[model samples]
Target: MTNPPSLLLVLSTCLHLLQWILDKLRITRLAQRILLHVLAAGPIPQHVAIVMDGNRRYARGKGKMVQEGHGDGYMALRRVLEICLRLNIQCVSVYAFAIDNFKRSPDEVDALMHLAENKLLELCSHGNLLQEYGVRLNVVGRLSLFPENVQVAVRKAEQLTKSNNRSILNVCMPYSSRDEMTTAVEGCIREALAEDDYFTESITEDTINSHLMSVQRGSPPVDILIRTSGVKRLSDFMLWQCCENTQLHFSKTYWPDFGLFDFVPIILEWQRSVWFRRHDVLFRS
Candidate 1:
């Protein structure tokens, strides 16, 4: 037999459970309709770029291997992509892997390469996802550096999504803003020489921009650059393209813990901020 005098304790426990259930139900409903009708009628951002950080830290904190963190981050990326699809964001760029990461320990590098290769394959092979979203896939990087299989998958994904127009998703693998800038400079030099024999010796910022990875590919300038894991720096991301007015949204949550639920709030906040800025500009103009 149980003690009958614990009436207050029973009531408190019951109330806590009821509150938790209500909160869960509320969040679920809210997620199903985060934007509702208002956002559907307003202007949405055309481009969003994200720097995914803190995978290793998350794994360490959870007493798991670092590679697991990458897997978690991959899941988070998928979630964000889905959110972008629903939100009608025209373009999204994710910093998948940096060239500097190649200098990591051999074992870790191998694991990461494997993960990236698998992810690329999945993106290419997931017919349902591709067909449903109509997302165009683009991978910006030194493709020669990737494994042969990864190269094949990247090409396949690009081909599969070539005609789609719902959104453009850019995955940056073994990529860096500085490297892109250098490449752009070289391209500008080559292009300018073709037009006139008396071409100048060097490239200006505007010329270089015309040759940039996104510019040549026809991507809008990044309206928002989100950095996860509480990091304050860009880590060589979009150094040339991200201008003075480009907004930054830094979240404390690890990439793996990030999902559509996390994306909605950031996007809403970004919309508000962009509106305010545009209003200010209009008034000043």
Candidate 2:
């Protein structure tokens, strides 16, 4: 006859199973608690921007289709957005697609456009995550450049979330830094021409900044710019907003592989850099 398992052994096995369940379900909450504690100790970036790079490369490495990689990147984006909401970050901007990307093959560009349209529509759907989090969505780019259907979807998403004040999510698609600057300049010139004192109202930094895409939504300049996939370059992302004071974090992990835990060290590093800058310790004569 087989002996029954001891009570202590059974209790230990049950405890381990319970721990595994909590780890799978509440891991994000644990990370949020740690991040909150860190925020209490130091300053948190008011505006965080991401140059979500390496989706295609990540997919290729895994022997998957490029579109599949983009899908994974979208999933990673969703997770990061949740983290931002939990951390109470005021604004978060993502480089979804750029104007130069239109030069790609027709099929690829079409796929990307379709993806954007679907995502925008999903955000505008009833009881979407944006509504739950009170996050206002802003699509900043030349809307006319996109397909009519995409334009309509983008407008719908923006309009639906326009009143939410908990946070701002900026999605830059078909966007170019150079074009944004030119547009700002043109807007400033138009404003100057409208005024009686055209010569007196010179185009200044503030004038250009006021006309920038994000300014219309009242988003502040980006304080931290993170790029995944080991890329160090900005790739024409948020050139004006990520000013001299913005801290840059380059991660080796691909965007699809980025997770909530990945952000903890980045925030800690930002705090360290801010502390050094404030104390005038990092600069050398």
Candidates' TM-scores?
0.84, 0.84
Candidate 2 on 132-251: residue-level lDDT in tens?
899999998888899999998998888999899999999988898888889999999988888854775598899899999887777898999999999899998899998788988999
**In candidate 1, what are the lDDT values of residues 62-129, reduced to their tens digit?**
99999999998988888788777777888899999899988899999899878877787787575656
Alpha carbon lDDT of each predicted model? 0.77, 0.82
Candidate 1 weakest lDDT stretch, 10 residues: 2-11
Model 1, which residues run further than 4 Å from truth? 1-26, 29-31, 34-38, 201-204, 281-285
Distance from true location, Cα of 205 in model 2, Å: 0.8
Model 1's alpha-carbon lDDT is 0.77
Model 2 poorest 10 in a row by lDDT: 2-11
Best by lDDT: 2
